[model samples]
Target: MPGLDYFSFAEMWSPLFLVFMLLIATLYAFVVGPWRQRFGGVEAVPVVRQLAFYGAMLLLYLVHGGPLSLLGHLMFTFHMTDMAISYIIVPPLLLYGIPGWLWKWAFGRAFWKPFRLFANPLFGLFAFNLLFSFYHMPDVHDWVMTHYVIHGFFYALLLVVALLNWWHVMCPVPEWSRVTSLRKLGYIFANGLLLTPACVLIIFAPEPLFAVYNDPQVWVQAMGYCVSGDPARLLEQFEGPAFFNLMSGREDQQLGGIVMKLLQEFVNIWALYSVFMQWYRKEKSQEDDPAFDHAASGRLNNV
Candidate 1:
C-alpha cells in the first residue's frame, strides 16, 4: 500500500489543529469537573457521558486533522467517508455527550433567543439536507474546495446545521425536545430520504463529477489547504492525486457514495431501534401504572 510517510508530519497530522482539539478537550474536562460548580452544575456528570464527549472529540480530530484528513484529499472514497463521519455521526455523539444543564447554561441566555428558530423541527429538517445536497453539486464542490475562506466557512455552517438537525433526535435536554418519540422516527426516515438524491447522483453518474479528483491541475490547487509547502512542489514530487489513488475516478466516486449511504442507513437503523424501544418502554410503564389504567378507564367510560 502507498504510505503517507512521504508527506510531512504537519500535513499528515495538522499539529495546529491537533493543539486546538486538545485545548478544547482540556477545557471540557475542566468545565465539567472543577468548573462545574461555577456553571451551577448540581451533580457530577455520568461517566458514560464523559466518555462519549471525549470519543466525539477524538473522532473529530482523527477525521479533520489526522491521517484520514490527508487521505481524504487524495481519494474520493475517503472524502465521502470524512463527510459521513463529520455530519452524520459526530453531531449525535456530541448531543448525547454534553449534559442537559450545560446545554441550558450555554443557550439559555436572552441573546440566544433569536437563534432558537434554528431549533424548529421543520427548519432543521430542510436546512441541513438542502445545504448538504447543494454542497455536493459538482461546481459548488470544486469552487468551495479551491477557496480556503469559503471552504472553512461552509464547513462550519454544515456542522452547525448538522447539530441542529440532530438536536430533534438526540434532544439532550428533555424539556427542550421539540419532536415526540414517534415523530423522531419519522425525522430519521426523512433524513435518509432527503439525502438519497445526492447519493444517487454520485453513485450512478457515468463519469466522475468532481474535477478536483479527476484533473491533476485542480487536484494540486485544492491540495494547498492540506499541504503546508509550496503547492508547485506537490505536482513535481507526487505528480498528482492520481499518484495516491488506487482506483479509477469513477470507481472511487461510486464507492464513496455507497459508503456514505451505507453508513447513513446504519446510523438511522440504530436511531430507529432506539426511538422504538423508548416508545415501547414508556407505553409499557404506563400500562403497568394503576393511575394510568384508572385514567384510561375514566376517559373511555366518558366517551
Candidate 2:
C-alpha cells in the first residue's frame, strides 16, 4: 500500500486548519475559565466535560483536516469511516463537553427562540437522517464532491443537523432537555433504523455506485477539493484513485457500508446502556428515599 508520506505536507496535516482548531480550543479555555463570570457561568465546568470537549475537537481535526481526510478521498472505506466518526461519534462528545451555562448563554436569547424549532427532537431526527441519506445517493454524492463551495456548505450544514440530532440524546443543559429518558432510548433506536437503508443500498449494490471512485476523470475532478495543484495532474501523477486503493471498487464500497453500520450500532448500544443505567439509578434513588418509604408505610397501614 502507498503510504500517506507520499502526500504533500499541506495535504496530510493541514497546518492552517490545525491552527484554527487550536485557536478554538484556546478560546474555549478562556470562555470557560477566565471569562466564566462574564458569560453567566455560576460554577466551574466539570473536568470530565472539559476533557470530552477537547477530545471531540481532536477527533474533528483528525477526520476533517488530518491524514484521514486525505485518505478518505482515495478510498470509499476511509470516507465512510470519516463520516461515521464525524457525524456519529463527534456530535455527542461535543454536546457533552460544553458547559450547560455556555450553551444557555449562547442560545438563550430571544433571537434564538424562533430558531429553537429546529432543535425539536423529531425535526432533528428526520432532517439529519434524510439529508444524510440524500447526500449518499450516487449522483448527489458525485456532484457534491466536485463543487467546492457546495461541498463545504453542505457538510457544514450536515454537521449542524448532526449536533441538533444529538442534542436530544445528550443535551448539556438538563433543564432544557425536551426528551425524557425513556423517549431518548426510543429516539436512538429510530435513528439506527432510519440510517440502515442508506447503508443497505451501499452494501448490496452489485457494482460500484459512485463515479468518483471508479472513473479516473471524475476522481481527478473530486480530488480538486483536497489537492492544491491542477487536479488533471493527478491523473498524470498517480493514474487515479485506484492507485491509492488497495481493494477493488466494489469491495471498498461494501466494506464502507459495513463499517458505517457497525459504528452506528456500537454508538447506539453505548447510548442505550448509558440511558438505561441512568434510568435505573434514578429509580433506585427514588425507592430508597425516606419520603417514599414513609408514604409507602402509610399506604400499607391504610390498606
Candidate 3:
C-alpha cells in the first residue's frame, strides 16, 4: 500500500536545495552589506576568529540543517545523533558567526523590549528546557510529524529556546556584558551538564519513549511522512521493526538512552573547547598586560 505520503519524505531534499541557495545568498548579503559596514569602521577581527565562527556555522549547516536533515528524513530514525546535535548543538555556533552589529540590527531593535522581558535568565532556563521537554513528549512529537503547522511551530519554538539559551553565552545584552572569558566557558559547560539527563534517559531507556518508534502506523503518522510499497521494506530498513521485535521495550529504551549519552559527549567536547579557548585568550591578554600584579595574579589563579 502506498502510505499517506503526507510529508512527501522522499522529496525532503528539495526544499533544502532551495534553502542552500538562499543561505548562500544571505551569507553573501551579510558579508557584503552588514559585515562590511560594521567592520569597515573598526579594526578587522583576527582571521582565525572569523574563520572559526564562520567555518563552524557553515559546517554545522551542512551537516545538520542541510544534507543531514534530508538524510534523517529519508532514513526515518530521528535518533539522538541528529536530534541532540541539530537542536542542542548547532544553533549557538551559527549565532556566533553573525557579526555583533547584524545581531543588534536584526533582533536587538524592534523585539528588544519584549525579548529582554522574556529572556531573563530564569525565564530562559525554564522556558527553553520546559518547551524542549514537552516537545519531545510522545503526543506532541507525534502531532508535529502529522501536521505541517505544528511541525513548523515546534521548530520555531525550538529556535526561540536556542536563541534564549545562547543569548547570555554568545550575544549577551549590554547590561550583562560583564561576562569574562572564564564565565562564558562555565556557561557552556553548565548547558552541557543541563542536557545530560535528557541524553541519559534516551540512551538507557528500557524501551522507546515515543510509541512511534515501534508502531509503523504511529511512526508514519508521527513522522507525517508517507511511506509506500513494501511494508516489509519500511519495516526492515526504516522503522527498526526488526529491532523492535527482537528487543524488549526496555532494551529499546536503553538504546535511545545510550545514543543520547553519546550525543552529550559530543556536545561536552565541543563546549569544553569553546570555553577553554575563550578563557585561554583572556589569560594571554592578562599575561601581556603591564597592570598585572599579585592581586591580578591571584584573581587569575582563582579563575
Q: Which stretches of candidate 1 lie over 4 Å from their true place?
A: 1-3, 293-303
Query: Which regions of candidate 3 fall more than 4 Å away from where they truly are?
Result: 1-12, 20-35, 38-67, 70-77, 172-178, 226-253, 292-303
Q: After superposition, how far is residue 234 of candidate 3 from its true place, in Å?
A: 6.6
Q: Which pairs clash in the backbone of model 1?
A: none
- For every candidate structure, what is the RMSD over all alpha carbons to the true structure, in angstroms? 2.7, 3.8, 5.6
Candidate 1 CA-lDDT value? 0.90
The all-Cα superposition gives candidate 2 an RMSD in Å to the true structure of 3.8
Best by TM-score: 1
Between 1 and 2, whose lDDT is larger? 2
Greater-TM-score candidate between 2 and 3: 2
Estimate, for each residue in 1-303, the C-alpha lDDT of model 2 and write its tens digit.
584566789988899999999999999999989899999999998899889889988988998899888888889999999999999999998998888988889998899887878988999999999999999999999999989899889988999999999999988899898887878899999999999999999999999999989999999898887878787987776778899888999999999999999999999999999988997797678778866775675474455
Q: How close is candidate 2 to the true structure, as a TM-score?
A: 0.94
* Clash count of each predicted structure: 0, 0, 16
TM-score of 3: 0.70
- In order of TM-score, best first, we have 1, 2, 3
Report, for every candidate in turn, its global Cα lDDT versus the true structure.
Answer: 0.90, 0.91, 0.57
Question: 126-243, model 3: which lDDT tens digit per residue?
Answer: 6776777676666676566568676767776777787677676665235444455566676666666666666565555555666655566655453333334533455544454333
Alpha-carbon deviation at 226 in model 1, angstroms: 1.6
Positional deviation of residue 198's Cα in model 2 after best superposition, in angstroms: 0.3
Model 1 RMSD, rounded to 1 decimal: 2.7
